[model samples]
Target chain A: MVKHKIVLLFPATVVEQPFLYHLVKDYNLIINVLKANINPRKEGTLVLELAGDKENYDSGIHFLESRGVKTVPLEQQIVWNEERCTQCGACTVICPTSALEMIRPEMTVTFNGEKCIACGHCLKACPARAVEEHY
Target chain B: MKVNRTYDEINERIKKGEAVVMTAEEIIPFVEEKGLEQAAREVDVVTTGTFGPMCSSGAFLNLGHPMPRMRMSEIYLNGVNAYGGIAAVDAYLGATEIPKTDPANTNFPGEFNYGGGHVIEDLIAGKEVYLEAYSYGTDCYPRKKLGTYIKLEDMNEAFMFNSRNAYQNYNVAVNLSEKTLYTYMGILKPNLGNANYSTSGQLSPLFNDPLLRTTGIGTRIFLGGTEGYVSWYGTQHNPSVNRSETGAPRTPSGTLSVIGDMKQMDAAWIRGVSFLGYGVSLMVGIGIPIPILNEEILRSAAVKDEELFAPVVDYSQGYPYGRGGPLGEVSYAQLKSGTIVIHDKEVPTAPLSSYPKAKEIAEILKSWIKEGQFLLTEPVEQLPSADSGKKLSPMKIRSRGEEN
Candidate 1:
């Protein structure tokens, strides 16, 4: 059976390096990293893409929990207030895994649970601060 | 007052292929030359270069000192005000007019006819200007040769072809920086079209061309020696040659290439230099944390990564891995309290080495988030504490709730 793939996201800083190093070293997993562009004016975040078996994935989560890190699961209703939404579409556009989609005709939006890697771009992009993770 | 490493020492390390950590004082000279202090003071925000101006067509590129070497100190500053020194300023130049062209006038062979006088005025005025000095549709001469207007439509097709080729190349770089990655991606404007244009004058559909869109994942981090990472991206059009009878009309033969073939000659000439400076800035910024949350820790990690990674990657080569110019070195004391100053100067020409380290750093940062180790630093007032017993009153309430 093929193992599942898990992704971890964090800010780019030294504080998180030790934790990431340990996770990468112990798990023997392939790590994917993301960060903001060169300009300081542009806002960006870092993402870690991990590929491994269920045990390794669970172990990574447990390690984060042990260190008091909050782990929000990917793709849930994520309560959203349409009033506060600027429709910047950062959530839909930056969703590396493509869990979110924009409904053009009705001007509504939808999210697919299975597709969400849970990078939390919607949380950052919503200028109105309307969207929040429900879990 | 100079702090940590002297200028000579830093230069030596840079010459020796090592990334020199810069301090605030060390970077002051460059900032002063760039006239950044006045620009920063006058504008609330600023943007510069092709990407800076094009992305915010109506905004100004705030000038900043080179990225400081002190890792922790710079981060503290950024944390205090995310928009302080690096925000985009309002544009002094007004709206640009896209010149209309007349296909009927075969005398001027091109799709657009930008007034020569207007073009010169914009360039001299320091506007975020874009021009195709050489293109099939337009003509651009040095300011001195403005009076000499020769009709190229009949005389030399080669001259017209070369000129158009040059302009297309220029626009490719400009569009890459202004349109593709920065303006379109950063501002979330999808109306802007891709850079690709066929000989038949047809443009590729939006998001269809990878060259016109940002790579799906973060590939690098821009280190700072002055302010932060400064980069440009775009496709290049290489004109092809075919044997035709002497009288046959010239066929414009070129395809728009993405950040493909990192080793292509023009790629090195254009993207390499733009990205090298960007890489240097990334190192500087990472080495000294800019005031975002957990900056100190991030700086430390970035420094460690730089130390480990710089040696392994070859700066002499193009893209992916390369060492940048000398890292400007400075001391901790200067960085903590002193301001990293910049004066006005012409933008420095492209750096020697071509490495995609900036992209690499960005990639690493993107992955770090996945690890769940990243935490945003909350404002001090927002943190719970005994001394600050008062809670933030409900926003958007105005007064005691009185329904309309």
Candidate 2:
């Protein structure tokens, strides 16, 4: 099974639709919503991790795009600036998935993008501004 | 054999490229294999380092006067306020000073993205910083206001003078409350989910000389990747705290007031940091070479992490309400082990101080001494001892407006 972090942008038109429920039931996928921000009658943005077979994952993306919802890889939006990181490990506690983990013995902080769910916690939680989110 | 070497004797060997030096971490194993006497007789200097957020830090800038100088009464750099009370062209910018327009906590958990610390970092990187100054027109100088861009090289003189730094030891902050706590200690998860600590453990400079035997006024040090000196005993320096048998303070104690030329400092060593919910602070890299004059000094310099202990404080109640400790005391060894048992719960632990960077700084300082470029200096006067009757005083609050 493949798990991918994707962000879904819902226009005001589709804000009331049942999109996540359909993705799980139709594609046989496991969906974990990391964060969701919706402005009443304006727009909505969702960050989620979806796990399924490769074919089902592709079909899920096609299904999402067909519903007038914009899909973007979470990796394309968030950046962990290694140059600015002092490896202080302050962001490690704030990160839920241990994505920003400190390498022991060396005590240096490293980011594993695969484990990140884009909760947007480490973006401002980082003291160095090393974690940036473009979206 | 007894070893009683003086600073002059050590400097003589350093001048001729014959001084033996080791970092604080390296000295531990060396002293373990060879005894303290042997290590003391052989090693000339033991270097120590710490890279952490020191909030009581700032820079003094002598911004060259504009063509029509007006005895500037107000000044700012990069939207952050600088203390303009010093002189017409001189100002002191503190690390935590945020912009006046910053929406600080009006919206809870404020994001202080930029501040004076960023300004200092930019200045040292040879980047242009926007400067704005205003003045009430004076007879000698008529210009009412000035706006210009300035660089570090253009300044008359720039120096970093931190009031308190290199805290000998600090508490391990945790949260016992049901809700999370956003603190200067970093974020503390609810119900003691995690613990956060700073200070480079054994590699910390003050921890090496717990009693301040060698580190004192006028002692040379590596500050922000440049040579600097201990200006004084730092503010709130309380050496009379609880201690271990080896003379290391189990609680936070002696601090150093350091000064260095900002013109010579490297941008990599001085960085701007923002703590979520808390304001901004400056992360400074400092390294001090402890002259191993005798076996006693060598023994102290070889102090290991296991011997160092810090109190675990609950930031939600204990830290903010009272300065009471130690939900339980844990050694640095336990702290570095990734988790600590607090109230029967295995809470994960993390350090705000970078051990790798601290080691890097210690290695760099060791190399400088080994290369005959850096020499040791005797402290002009030693810091006050734990038995010196020194106490950290608190401000007297006058509810009736009774002036002190």
Candidate 3:
């Protein structure tokens, strides 16, 4: 089985569609949502970790694109500036997944992008403005 | 046992390589092992440090006198505005000022790419900043306007004159509502998702001092990097805050206003920061050396995070004015553990202040003292310990025939 972390952007018109349900029912894929900002009559975004057969996952992604949804990987999104960070550890607490942490003795803040859920909590919490979200 | 080493005596010992010095973090364990009386006699100096975002900080600069001298009524540095009301050649740049590109009324966190704090950082980094000024032409000095670039070294006098800093202790923040919060305390997650505190805890200057005994006016300190002096009691300094038996405040109290020359400061110790959807502020590095004058001072400096307690306030209730009340008191050790329990639910904790940097500053100060490069200064003036308890009166319109 292959696992992929991706974001599904739904245009305001497609906000009512149950795209996530179809992934589990029709595509036979496991969907663990990391974040969801779906509101009626508004553009919606869903970040999910999908796991299934490689062929099934590929087909599911193709089906999502065919339905006028935009897909982007999590890697292309966030920027963490280490030079400007004072290692205050403000971002580590609000991080839903253990993406950010403070190292011992020196009290430096370390970020592991692989574990990040992209909740954007650190963006505001940071007094140094070291964390930035491009998308 | 009476232990008293005057500033001159301490300086003499330092010169003779006989003075004993240690960081506040290091002296605690030594005092615990040797007892306060012994430690007080042996340890000459205890260095205290704190690295945090000090919003009430700024710098005053005296740029060179321009030809055909003009009174600068308007000034901008690196595209950020500076207050030119002081004098024709001097200006004050605030730390939290929003840049001209993003005026206050613009929108949420409007394009705060650079600000006054950034300009200060750039200046200290030895970068040239564009300066622009406008003034009404005067008969004695008829220059109408001027524009130029200025470097820190080129300015006649540049000093950080912070009106308030080194807070004795502060509140820990949390959000109880369904929505999140962004504050100087860092981000507070919804439904107690997280708690944010901004202090170095045991390593903070005020944390070590507890009471305002040794850290009064004229106290020499390591501000940024160069030597600085505590000028006065900071604004809103409430020494009357209720405290625990150990002397840690249950509320905000005892603050210091300090001044230091920018020529001696290093850019690495000063920085500009922008809070997302909030505003810009300065990240300052301050280190204070506390002399072990007696057993009382030694005991106070030995206080640890586990023994000190702070209130976890709910900021979602309306920030500073919120009446949601304190959830509970927790020690710095518990908060530093990365997780806290609020209302019987597990919540993670984050710190806005850099304890590692605070430790680093203390180490730096210790080295300076050990090498006899930094000397301790006895306070020239004692800080006021009593609160005036005076209330601010609101402006009222005069009634007909009233106060004729």
Local distance difference test scores for all models: 0.25, 0.91, 0.82
Spell out the clash pairs found in candidate 3.
Answer: none
Candidate 3's residue-wise lDDT over A13-129, tens digit each? 778888988989989999999889967659888888999999899999999999999998875566788877888888787666768887654567988877877888777666677
Which parts of model 2 have CA positions greater than 4 angstroms off?
A11-18, A21-30, A39-41, A66-68, B323-325, B399-404
CAPRI category for model 1: incorrect
List all candidate RMSDs to the true structure: 29.1, 2.2, 4.8
**How would the candidate models be sorted by TM-score, starting from the highest?**
2, 3, 1
On residues B1-404, what C-alpha lDDT tens digit does candidate 3 reach at each position? 48876778888887787889888788879988998888888998888889888889999999878889988888899878899998788999998887676865357544455788888889999999999988987887688899998899999999999988988778888888897666666656689988888888889898788777788899999998788899998877877767777777766677889999998898878888776555778888999988887888878788888877888889888456647678888988888887789899988787788998899999998888888888888888878653444222434679988873
C-alpha lDDT of residue A117 in model 3: 78
Error in Å for residue A57 of model 1 = 3.0
The sequence of per-residue lDDT tens digits that candidate 1 reaches over residues B294-363 is: 2221122222111110101111221123234212221112111112111221111111111122222233
Q: Locate the minimum summed-lDDT window of 10 residues in model 1 chain A.
A: A35-44
User: Of the candidates numbered 1 and 2, which has the greater DockQ value?
Assistant: 2
Give me the candidate number with maximum TM-score.
2
Runs of candidate 3 exceeding 4 Å displacement: A1-79, A103-107, A132-135, B103-106, B109-111, B322-325, B386-404
Provide TM-scores for the models.
Answer: 0.22, 0.95, 0.84
